[model samples]
Target: MNQTRYPELAGKRVWITGSSSGIGAGMAKILAQQGCKLVLHYCRNETGVQQTLQTVAELGAEVEVVWGDFADYASLENVFHQAWSAFDGLDVLINNAGIVTKSTALNDNTGAAFNRTIAINLQAPYRLSTAFAKACIDAKQPGVIINNSSIHGQQTCEWFSAYAASKAGLDAMMKVMAVEWGPKGIRVNSLAPGVVPVERTAKILAEPKMAATWTKTMPLQRFGHVDDMGWATAFLISDSAAWMTGSVLTVDGGLIARGGYPARE
Candidate 1:
C-alpha cells in the first residue's frame, strides 16, 4: 500500500459503488491509503468485495460494505440512505459502478441490453449523485463527486452503441450537475480512462499481439494500470483540484490524442 500523501483527506467519509472489483476496488484501496472512511458497494461478488474490504482494512481504513442492484432503480434511494448513514454522511461519492455491454445495434433491437446498460451505467450514477448532492445541500456541507467514465464517451468504435451512449450521457450529466452544484460547493467531474486493463481484461490485453496493437496507438507505449486511476481519483477529490469542476480528466496515456493515424517510425 502507498503512503497517504493527502493528509487533508484523512477521516473523510466516502462511498464507492461497484467496489467489488476492478477500478472500484482500486479506488477503495487508494482512498484507504489516504485515511478515508469508506462505504464500499457491490451488486454481487461477495468474495471480491470481502477481499477489497480486507485489503483496505489492512491499510488501516475504517471500512463498511453495502450492496444494491442499480437495475432496480426504485431501490437506489434506500441504498443511498444506507450508505449515507454508515458514517453519518459522506464527503465524497465515487460513481464507479457500471457495465460494459458490447453488442451491435442490430443484436439489441429490443433495446433490452441497451436499457439495462443505461440503467446501471447512467441512471444509477444520476440517481446516486442526486441523492448525494441533496444530502450535502441539506447538511450545508461541501462535497465532491467523481464519475468513472470512459474514452468511449469522447471517441468510439463498433459494438459500443449502448456503452458509448451511456458514458456520453454520464459526461454530459456530470457537466450539468457541476453547473448546478457549483454555487452550493459541490463539485462534479468525470474521470475518462483509456485502455486500462483490469481483472476482466488483463489476460487478453497481456497477449503479445494484443498488447502491441493497443500500445502502439498510444503515445505512452503502455497500457494504463489501476493505480494510475487511483492517483487520478485522489487528485480530483484532493484540494489540488478545488477549483476544477465540470471537467473530464482524460487519463488515456495519449490513446485518444493519437487518433486513428498509423504508428510513425
Candidate 2:
C-alpha cells in the first residue's frame, strides 16, 4: 500500500461517487495513496463518508465530500457541479454510484424496482459523465472517466434482470462516449468486477459453504477483494493504460471465462 504505482497520478483531481464505503471506499483509499486530490460523494452514508474522509486525510490526500440521491435525477447536475467546484476542477470522474436490485422477471410486475435501479445505476452515471465531459471540453483539459460496471453486463444469472440491464447499458454508453470524446482527450472505460465481497454481502459470502461453492466455479478459485477492484481502477486511470478506452476490463478471477457450466465430475 505504501508503493505509488503511478507517480503521474500525483496532484490529479479526482471525483468518486458512492465512495462512502465498500468498493468505492477501497478505490478512494488507493487513489489517495497515489497522491490524487479527491472529491468523495455519498447518498446517505454520512458516517461512512466521515471515515473515508479521515482515512484519506491521514494518507495526506486533499479531499472534499458531497452527497446526493441519484434516484432524484433532477438534482444530479447540481451534485456534479458541487463535486467539480470542490477542487476548482477535476481530472478524473469515477461513476461508481449504483444499486444492485435482484428480482425475477415475474416477481415485480410493476417494474418499480427496475426503474429505480436504472435511475441510480444507469441514468445517474449517464448524466454525470455528460456533465463531466462538457466541463472538461469547455476547459480544454484532458479528463478520464471510469465506470464501475459489473460482469453482469457481459453475462448474468437469474434474479438480476434490472442489475444486468443497467450495467449492460452502462457499458454500451461508456463505449459510445469513449469514441465520441476520444478526439477531445476524454478517455472513458469500465471496470467489470465479479463477486467482490463488500460490507453488504460479507455475512452471507463468509459462510464456509457459500464461500466454497462460489469460489469453486472461478478459475482462480477465490472471491475478489475490494482492494483488487481498487488496484484495477487505479490502473485504468493511470498512464499505463494511456491508450486504453472504450473497453471493459474484467477482473473477475476468470469466473466468466469458466462459463456457466458445472464443475467437472
Candidate 3:
C-alpha cells in the first residue's frame, strides 16, 4: 500500500503470469493502484487468483483473471492470446510464472526434472515474450516485457541445478529479446530477486538457523518482501525506466554483494 503514483502506468494494459500469489500478486496490487488494466494469470490456484482479483478490484482498477499451464505449449500460446485479447492489446507482459525444484545434477532422474523446470521457467517466458512482441509489432504499438528471474541465475546454490539453469536461461533470453525487439519499441528486462518469503519458500523460512544465517549475510539484514519486488516491477515497466532494457535488476537486499560469505559465528 505504498501509494507512490506512476502517471505513465495509468490506463495501460498489463498481463502478469502466475499472479495468483507471491510476487506476481504483489505486482498486480501495486500496478492496480497505478490505474493499470490488469490481466492476472494463474495455473491451478483459483482461490489465490480470486483473492488477487478481489484485491485489485477493491483498489478500483479494471482487472480480469485467466488460467494456463506453462508446461503445455498449446496452453501457453492460448494464454498469451487470451491475455492480449482481454484488453484488445497488452502494453506490458510480466513473465512471472516459474518453478524451482530440488534436484541434483548427478541424479539419474535429473533430466526429467530439469526439462520440466526449463519448460515452465524458461521456455514459457520465451514463447510468451515472442508472441507479445510480435503482436505489438503487428499493431505498431510499443510494449514492455519483464521476466521474473532469481538470484540463483547468477549465484550457486546446492540442489538447485535445474532451477538455477532455468533462471539463467531466462536472463539470457531477456537480453536477446531486448536486442531483437528494441528497434520495434519493445523493451525486455529481467528482475532477479533474492529470498522473498512466500508460500513457496514457507518451509525454508521457517527454519530459525537457516533464516538467521541468511539474514546476517545480507547487508540489509533481512529477506526481501513482496512489495519490494512489486515496486521494482512497477518502476521498470514505467516510463521512468524508458532507457533501461536488456538489463538485470537485482533486488536482493545486498545479499549478492556479500559474495556468498557466511555471517561471523
Candidate 4:
C-alpha cells in the first residue's frame, strides 16, 4: 500500500502503548512513514517490540521502544514518563494496550480475570490520559490522544462482558477527557474498530465457520485490515481532524450498522 505522508505529522513525537504487535504496531509503521518520531511500548513481547523497531527504522523514522505492564499503576506511570522524556516532549498519546480473556463469564468463581481486564483496558487509559493532558497543560502545548476502543464497546458478544464494559468505560472516559481538556488545546477521542485480523484474533479468525459468519454479517463482506485501522488512527491524530474531539469513530466495516445480522447457517 502506498503511504500518505502527512506533512503536519512530520517530526511530531508520538507514544503508542501495546505497540509491539497487532494494531498498535500497524499504527506505528504508518505514522513512521508520515515522518513522526515514535516511542513504542510493550509489556513483555521483547522480540515483537524489537521487530517493530526494526520495521519502523527501515522507514527512516526515529523510533524508541519502552517496556511496561499496564496492570501495574506505578509501572504504567514510569513508562509514560520515560516516553514523554524520550523525545524531549510528546505531541500525541495512543492508549492501545488491552486484554480480552476468552470464556470470561460474569459469575465466574474468581473475579480476578474481570478485575485485570478493567485495570488494563479502562484504568490504564484513564491514568495515562490524565498524565498526558497534565503534561501538555503545564507546557502550554497542544496535544492529541487516541484511545483504541473496540466495537464490543457498543455491541456485545457472548463471553465478553468484562471486555465490553472496559471498552465502554474507555469511550465514556474519552468524552469526558475531551470536554475537560479541549479548552486547554488537547484533543481526546476513541477509535472503535471492528474485527481486525491481528495476532490476538488469529485463533478466532482461524475458525472457518466463525470467519465466514463475520464475512457474511459485515456489510463490506470482509474483515478489517490492520492498515485500515492504522490509517484511520493516523487521520484522527493529524491536524486534519483538528475540529474533532470526544468522538468515537467506528471502523467496523459496517458491522455495527447491521445490528448483529445473523450469519447464514
lDDT of 2 by residue, 69-135 (tens): 9999899999999999999999999999889999998998999999999999999999999999999
Error of 3 at 249 (Å): 0.2
Candidate lDDT scores, in order, read: 0.95, 0.95, 0.91, 0.90
**Could you tell me the TM-score of candidate 1?**
0.99
- Name every residue pair that clashes in candidate 2: none
Mark the regions of model 2 whose C-alpha exceeds 4 Å error after superposition.
none
TM-scores, one per candidate: 0.99, 0.98, 0.96, 0.96
Model 3 misplacement above 4 A: 108-110
List model 3 lDDT by residue over 1-265, tens digit each.
5385787898999999999999999999999988999999999899999999999999998998888999997677888899999989999999999887887778837499899998999999989999999999999999999999999989967899899999999998899889988999999999999989988886888699998888888999889999899999999988889999999999999988889666665
Residues 35-62 of candidate 4: C-alpha lDDT, one tens digit per residue? 8999999988998999999999998889
Worst 10 residues of 4 by lDDT: 100-109
**lDDT minimum window of 10 residues, candidate 2:** 1-10
Model 2, C-alpha of 202: deviation from truth (Å): 0.6
List clashing residue pairs in candidate 4. Answer: none
Which parts of model 4 are misplaced by more than 4 Å?
A: 263-265
